[model samples]
Target: MLVDQYNPFEGKMLQILDQEGNITDEKLLPEIPDEELVRLFKIMLYTRVIDRKALMYQRQGRMLTYAPNEGQEACQIGSVYALEQRDWMAPAFRELGAWLTRGVDLKTLYLYWYGNEMGSKVSEEIRILPVSIPISSQLLHAVGLAYAAKVRGLDEVSIAYFGDGGTSEGDFHEALNLAGVYKTPTIFLCQNNQWSISVPKHFQTASETFAQKAYAYGFKGIKVDGNDIFAMYAATKEAVDRARKGEGPTLIEAYTYRLGAHTTSDDPTRYRDNTEVEAWREKDPVKRFRIYLEKRGLWDEEIEKAYVAEKEEEVEQVFADIEQNGGTAFDDVFMYQYAEMTPILKEQYAEWKAFFQERGML
Candidate 1:
């Protein structure tokens, strides 16, 4: 039976619980302590609260354009918490939960969406790259960092998070090929949210599954229910362990749904149906996890109230900080480049500064 179950093209997909909050497979479960499970759930709740608050802030004109990971908290937080602090993280635009789990302050995240460049200036000690907006470009950075760690004899690994659309990028193919050939300790996590902007998953690729693409690169892959926090945690832990042990890379295609618009600038309703959105709402990560917690007798009305109150307070504080530092000066754009600025950049900077000064806006 075990021999029949083994297939090289079939990734080791492990899911512990179903959407109905029923445990489907207990044997594949990891030894997660109850306390840690509760902690992870709380972080997931925090992410949801932050996402909602960020959306409100954007709508109220208090923040610049924002991307809300409304239904992807479990996918981001579970994978992030499974990693060691020394391991590097490279994330695309929608990774607030991952950044928060990596110890980035909520205030800084808010600042980033508020048009402050300092928001992306994470401390070197944190080992998280700035949010990459150019799609799958960060995968190359993750591969390089993992390669460097391997050369330095360090047990560290690098994880890059991108969406299904990113899988079609040339950079994604290049990074995966190089990592496989060199055996770099990297994790290529693709959050298959079923839609890339307005395009559906059916149009993203012709392959039956994103995990199967890893076969061409000579690496193993897995597909997991991204809404299942336990599954994501378990799968990421196994992948990270293998990478740290010098077993090369793993491609994880986290199957999930983007319940909200791509960003504040997008209107998903224009391209999708309300019935489809309602269908995905039934599989919400927060609701499913809450059901699991309740079944375990770990959740209650009073506890929910307390958690909501605390999250509201924390979000209020973040908004306050963002308001205090809302404005960005024209000079701030020229600080983070190379040792010397190009002639064109200098000319443009001078023009922008003068324009802002004349308008009394700097």
Candidate 2:
């Protein structure tokens, strides 16, 4: 098994592609069909464009505080591509690439970030939870979902996406422990982007690698090259297969880097050095995947230019639509907290409306 072959405790990190984008071993390359590989690249490009435009909109005060997924595209898109339609994904807030790859609407993301509560509404067909902003809380929800699936005699695997910092949260450990003991079909995907909102990886944990933490909870752990799309896909596909076969859970620590600020409100420059950022920029995931596609004759500069232009136009229109008619409805704010709002909630919402009306601000 790939998990056994690349043992995290032994300090072995999987790297199917090097920084220069050359495949390290032909045998290690994932069996993604050529067409699907091209689609993955196109989606990754679209994700990057959306992320960049979101940053621009936030800076211009057209949106709320937003997280940027600049350098971690492969870590999300690749793993999500490995998922079958029946699988479920629970994502932390920064998983813009995964959100897009997993069939989320482009306008929904924009509306959500633009302070519209309606943006969080998703179709019943999509199996993604609303973005969990409170650290590693989503992992617990994923475990519950996985356990529920097992009880229902279904083989649908659940994957939870989190960051390196989330590993420190109590919810992280509790979720892993429960999944381990229950032998739930959960895939813990932690994007160890070398920082937990400004805390370096070394300070986050004394263990040599975050993947090693899985051993304490009784499952296999894999340390992988997050920037290498092939490695991410292979690891996730293997993990997904293992889960469906009732092999229990696996924790995958994607060793990636955050190329942008923690969020729109953050200033990475205050805590990190430019030289370090530049060094990681050389290993940018999007660039590495593009190089891989070029080598496979699936992509070129001309295709990239046209594809980027099309995505830019599409993103602009999505945002434009949101601006024109997608603002949050006043009633939506009070309706979703509970199936039926309690008297306190009703009073609070009504009191706010009365205040706004008194000031002619409603």
Candidate 3:
């Protein structure tokens, strides 16, 4: 058969937790303490709450477009929680899980969705780049950052987050090739959430698996059950350790699904089937992790109720602050663009201020 003679590589799929919240294997389990595992679960819960609220706000016209990361929480939280504070992360727009894990404030996150540039101005201590809107562009920035770290002999790795469709972009290949040539300590994280906006995964690529593409660039690639938190954590931990040891890059194709609409602007029902989404929902990352935690005596009804209530109050307060403050200033647009505003920009800024003042918005 033609398929038998020309196979380049087989994707190594890893799964530690089953869909029904049972441990399939003990050997593949991540070596995390119970306390740390509980913390990870809490982060996932917080992400779900934040994502759901963002959607509610979007529907109510309180916020702009937002990409919900509801089902892929494990893929994001497990990988980000494994990284050191000094490591760098370049995230695409749908990475609230990573942002929360990295300590980005809820207010700042909410402000971003409120169409404010001020929200993008994250503190340097977090070490996460601003969200990249253009698909696959963040990979190049990640490669540059990783190469710079290598040149400076810093023990840090730069992780680039993209979707399955992003792999088809030219920048994706260019970044991977450059990282391979320079042996940059970079981790290419492809959150294969099944759909890139409205495009299906099979239509995006003919390759059997996204992970196999890494071999062409001279790096190892592994596929993990993205909904399984333990599997995601183990794969990322291994890749991070390899990068810290000066080894070349690794490509991690997280085999997961997006259980929501692509964003507030696009509806998945037009192109995707309800059955497919429902099937993936059964493998929901947060629900699966919660079950695992409960089995290990790390979770209880009281704890769940308390945590949910706490996050709800916190998110409500954040929205209240945004509503009361009239959101971000219009000048915030030009202020972050340049060190010193040009004369034309200054004139435009003044015009905006006058317009707002006339309308009692100043």
Using TM-score as the measure, the top candidate is 2
Q: How displaced is residue 45 in candidate 2, in Å?
A: 0.6
The alpha-carbon deviation from the true structure for residue 288 of candidate 1, after best TM-score superposition, in angstroms, is: 1.6
Any idea how many clashes model 2 has? 0
What number of backbone clashes does candidate 1 have, counting pairs of residues 3 or more apart or in separate chains?
0
Candidate 1 segments exceeding 4 Å error: 1-13, 339-343, 354-362
Better model by lDDT: candidate 1 vs candidate 3: 3
Clashes of each: 0, 0, 0
* Pairs with backbone N, CA or C atoms under 3 Å apart (clashes), candidate 2: none
**Candidate 1 residue-wise lDDT, 1-362, digit = tens:** 11113232554555676789877878766688888878888888888888899899899988889997988988998888889989999999999878988899887788889888878888788999998999899999999999999999998999999999999999999999999999999999999999999999999998878887887998888888898888888888888988988889988888889999999999999999989988988989888888888999988778988998999998998789668866776567786654588888899888888998899987
Task: Write the residue-wise lDDT of candidate 2 on 1-362 in tens digits.
Answer: 88999998777999898888899989999888899889988989999999999999999988999999999999999888889878899999999889888889898888888989877877778899888999999999999999999999997999999999999999999999999999899999999998888899889999999899998999989999999988999999999999889989999999999999999999999999999999999999888888888998999999999999999999999898888898777878898878899999999999989999999997
Candidate 2 lDDT (Cα, 0 to 1): 0.92
Clashing pairs in 1: none
Mark the 10 consecutive residues where model 2 has the least summed lDDT.
117-126
- Candidates 2 and 3 compared: the better one by lDDT is 2
Instruction: Please report how far candidate 2 places residue 154 from its true position, in Å.
Output: 0.8
List the lowest-lDDT window of 10 residues for candidate 1: 1-10
